[model samples]
Target: MNFSEVNIGLFRLVNDLGKEHEQLNIIFTFLAEYMVFLLAISVICIWFTRNKESRIMIFCATITFTCAFILGKVSGVFHSNYQPFVELSDVNKLIVKEKDNSFPSDHTILFFSYCFSFWLFKRGWWIFWILLALLVGISRIWVGVHYPFDVIAGMILSFAVAINVYIIVPRLNGTKKILNVYEKYEGKLFQPFRKTKGSKTRNY
Candidate 1:
């Protein structure tokens, strides 16, 4: 049918899937909630490394996250789409109800924006980050708080923001200056945590 009908249909399909098993519900909910923490930890680890590539990555991610957040907030002002649980009669909402705009899922936008920004640079392990981002988006729909279209829009906007940030950040002279400063001081700041070369760990 039309786009709204399609949205409802997909929402029903995945929302029902969540109701089929308690384990799936728990798994999806956990993924939606905690996957961002994993991404944050990754950013922190990358920040500590302080190499050129890591510097560029963290910079792009920082811009992407900021743009995504601003766009998400602005989207709510223009289009306030209600949650599926709010509009539909029977929704298996595994997560807590949210009354905010659902047109573009904020969680999806933030995580996917970060993951996609990194993937634009590094081509290997970032693939897992992309998949994790997809899983997080799907989990939002599965939990019945977001319509499929909401998640899809979030992904589309996130990719757009990430690509723009990736392209634009490297061209700025200030980026190089800040990165130089960060690299210069990173070793001193983390000296206590730095491991010696050729150090061996004892096995218990």
Candidate 2:
């Protein structure tokens, strides 16, 4: 069989599980839909920490995601497919999605771009981010919104961008300068709330 046949068969394997086990459908549905908001909140919280390392990590992640997103769009121009539910029979579609190009799943691109950047920057306890990315990719397939090839293509594209961003961004003098300028303004903005020695209450 050709690649498209294999892609559909793999999608069927994952999507069919939702029909057999109702409980997993709920989990995968959440991962497919709402987990992105959680990831966004986490990134914002990390940025507010004002720690240089965390800020740099966030910068690298942002750049990685931007580049990957552009690449995904470009790839869509060349190759595009509707969602699996739109193309195949007996799809276990769990979420509401409009009919559009589903090649190189956008969710997969987004999660892997940021999560893999997190893994590269903080290797210890942050490894869960990689697992989270993988689950999100699978969840897209399990929800019947994407084919296996869509998710796989996204993973490969984001991983390549993430690795390059991690290597190049940190070494750039402009990255450091931008961080320093932002931190300078940030410190002033929050200065009134900072506690002073021998003062029980903050100035603000």
**Which candidate number has the best TM-score?**
2
Minimum summed lDDT over a 10-residue window in model 1 is located at 195-204
Candidate 2, backbone clash total: 0
Clash totals for all candidate models? 0, 0
lDDT of 2: 0.91
Predicted candidate 1 versus true structure: per-residue lDDT over 6-102, tens digit per residue: 9999999888997787678888998877888888888888776646787688888888888888888888788777899889988998878757678
Worst 10 residues of 2 by lDDT: 195-204
What is the C-alpha lDDT profile of model 2 across 1-204, one tens digit per residue?
999899988999999999999888999999999999988998999898768899999999999999999999999999999999999988999999999999889999999998988888873347888888899999999998999999999999999999999999999999999999988998888776674532655443
